[model samples]
Target: MYMRNRTLLPATPERNFQMTAKERREEIWRLIRSGLGSQDDQARATGFTVSRVCDYRRLWKFILREHPAIADGVTCEEALSLAKEQGVKTKR
Candidate 1:
């Protein structure tokens, strides 16, 4: 014969999720487009660390080099999509 279990645990509330790298990049781009120049402003707007914002800047430069059209009023989402389509890997 098997013994029955009796203990039950209470459910915990879920915490808010953090932004992913792609989302952070997109947010940073938006801030830049909206004229937020400083890294501090980007960090505040995107909730990313200063180093991560700097990383995004580096990635943006690389992306711009590979795709000049991205600098010509292309949306951040479109640029990211094009980068993926071209198999350009973002730094992890």
Candidate 2:
């Protein structure tokens, strides 16, 4: 007699539509900090492409100007949450 298990691994949810560009940029910075090094090193460790790393850095600079608290070691999720709490909207 053969028995089949009904349990199956759940599929990963799609990430494309969930995070906005700002959120994505913040996430990249978080990855960089989590690695504790330069963009090149962070990219290597996080598996992000060099071009993506550059974009993240540029976006991070812009975000930092708008939100100084981000530089104070706030997590990307926290930053996004704070922005939401403040009713900030992303530019289209």
Query: Against the true structure, whose TM-score is highest?
Result: 1
* Error in Å for residue 8 of model 1: 53
> What tens-digit string does per-residue lDDT give for candidate 1 at 22-51?
665666776655545477655655666778
Looking at candidate 1, what is the lDDT of residue 39? 71
lDDT by residue (tens digit), candidate 2, 1-92: 11123322112224524666665556566755443456655444334567777655554554577778656677656655655676654322
Q: How does residue 65 of candidate 1 score in lDDT? A: 85
| Residue 4 in model 1: lDDT | 19
- For all predicted structures, in order, the TM-scores are 0.51, 0.43
lDDT of 1: 0.58
**lDDT: worst 10-residue window of model 1:** 7-16
